[model samples]
Target chain A: MVEIEIDEDACVGCGSCVDDCPNDVYQMNEEKWKTEVVKVEDCMACLSCHEICPAQAMEHRDIHVAKRLYIDRKVNDVLDKII
Target chain B: MDMEIEEIRGTFRPELIPKETGGDIEDYEEALHVLMKFVGSMSSALEQVSGRGANAIVYQAGKRMGHDAAKMMEKTDNLEQAMKEMGEVLGVEFYFEMWKPSDQEGYTIEKGNETVVKLLFMDCVVRQTLRRTGLPQKGPLCYLLYGYMVGAVEEVMSIKGKLDIDHVGPNACLKTLTIKWGGK
Candidate 1:
């Protein structure tokens, strides 16, 4: 399981990660360019955004299946509506 | 310069490189134009529209006097606090933003005693609101301050390779700057 982290200060609000994520895990907040983790759990272990991000603002941590999988499933539940 | 020592230092990542392979002088100028506009837009949006002027105005903060109360910070001492109070009165702020190429993964540079992290592009903005205080314009001081920042950044870039960091445009309202890496 993977834990996703996004640095609000580092994020440029480019929306690249939002578009690239196949799992539909991120969304842009209205006020700022930063992405809000509306669905933390939907992350599919795919690191496309991690590799593609130009800002070096995103990171992931590998964790036990129990802790990691919970966020992944929780996020995916919300992903259906936004994506 | 000796009397005033108020300063803040920062670094940005991913050294910026030209998108094109080779070009003439016009190309270089155009690149700088694009870079300047990019930084200016970001700065204007943050300074003018964001309602975060206090944060953006670094120099103004330098002149502040007689502050009421705020929690003490461990990292800062009394003298530093006093200087900060003065800064608050002056209404000065320095803001920096950086853009860099992703492939290089960013790097750092060392100057006399400073180490600067390389960025694709870095913009150091100095906003001074003097309020027509009958004081001589501090434009030169602002330019000099930013010049030091650029020099530090260039020192870092030079270690990796020769990059030409130049002041592209200088206007009263704003200035345009750019650092071009690699030779034509």
Candidate 2:
């Protein structure tokens, strides 16, 4: 099962996730203007919402996390020291 | 910043088979990254030069690879069994599973003369390479996997097949594979 958490404080109510999700997993709470997980059953954990969210308000748990081989660890180490 | 390069020196004999693969983990990692960059650049360039034709070319190449890889395997018309065998051949790198909506009872669907199934690809090397290059989904590179699956299924079942991209997500991709009866 996929568990999704929406940070209400961080949510900007932009509705990008509501538009971007293919499975209609999210819906806008019109009254509050924040995003809510309406249909959690259909959420495939695609994480497109996470990528599009400017505020990084969403998190997905217990899902098949794809391998991210693109990140160069050595470069990251250097950045870690500088940042 | 200045980068340091370390060179390795070795003695080679023409007649003898090399026993060990020389290189540390860092070397392998560096080589893998370099290869990924090379492939990413090649795919992007091919797409730019050949446009949509690039997909056909890449698909054909992937199909050829699939056929060659599955040639030695036992042939069967059982789709489920063939998929299981193919999973072993593809290994963990291309991990995938049959998927259906929660409301649906079974994975396979039959309509008319076609048998359809949805495959959810969780970890695909092509997807990784695309992400490495910062390319969007549903590009020509995606066709490679589509053709590869079709080719493998065709080889195993001795039937014609097609794969359609349903949805592409960062964590997973859903593809519809339809096998047609009778010819090809």
Candidate 3:
């Protein structure tokens, strides 16, 4: 099962997610002008909404996170120390 | 910034197989990154030189490889069974599963002589390589996996098949695989 959360404060109501999601997992709350998850059952956790969301308001939980082997560990290590 | 290089000397014989592989995890990571860069460069250069023809070349190469890999597998007419076998063949590097919408009762839909199934690719090396090289998705490189899946399915089911990308994301990608029942 996939759980999605949208921070209302962060949501700008751009409807980017609503348009970008192929599965129709999200819809804009027209009254509140915020984004909401409408069809949670169909969400595949592709995270395209997360990428397109300017405010970064959405979060997905309990989904299979794909492996990110492209990241350079040494660069991250250096940044960890500096930050 | 400076590192030490360790060298191993061993005698090699055709009949004797080495039980252990040389180099550590770091070496492997370095090698993997280098290969990704090399492949990325090749894909980009090929695209620039060959234009759209690059995709066909890469797809043919992948199809040949897929056919070769599927040669040892058992042939079957069942799409689901063939998908299971393909999952094992693809392994974790290109992990994928049949997907369907909540409203759909079955994973597959039949339309006349054609059967269509949605595939959700969760982990993919081509995606990783593209990200590593800062290349966009749906390029010629993506056709490699497309051809691979189509080729494998064709070999396993003895039917003509095609795969189409529906969407691409950082974590996952969705594709549609259609098989023609008597198109072999």
> What order do you get sorting by TM-score, best first?
3, 2, 1
- DockQ-based ranking: 3, 2, 1
Q: Could you give candidate 2's per-residue lDDT for residues B17-129 as a string of tens digits?
A: 55556778888888888887888888889999999899999999889877877777789987778878888887677788888877788888888988888888888888888
lDDT of each: 0.40, 0.86, 0.92
In model 2, the runs with Cα more than 4 Å from the true position are B13-18
Q: Which is superior by lDDT, 1 or 3? A: 3
lDDT of 1 at B141: 25
Can you give the TM-score per candidate against the true fold? 0.24, 0.93, 0.95
lDDT of 1 by residue, B37-104 (tens): 55444444544554545232422332121111111312222222322332332222232223222333
The best candidate in terms of DockQ: 3
lDDT of model 2 at residue A32?
93
lDDT of each residue in A1-83, candidate 3, tens digit only = 99999999999999999999998999988899999999999999889999999999989999999999999898899999999
lDDT of residue B44 for candidate 1 = 43
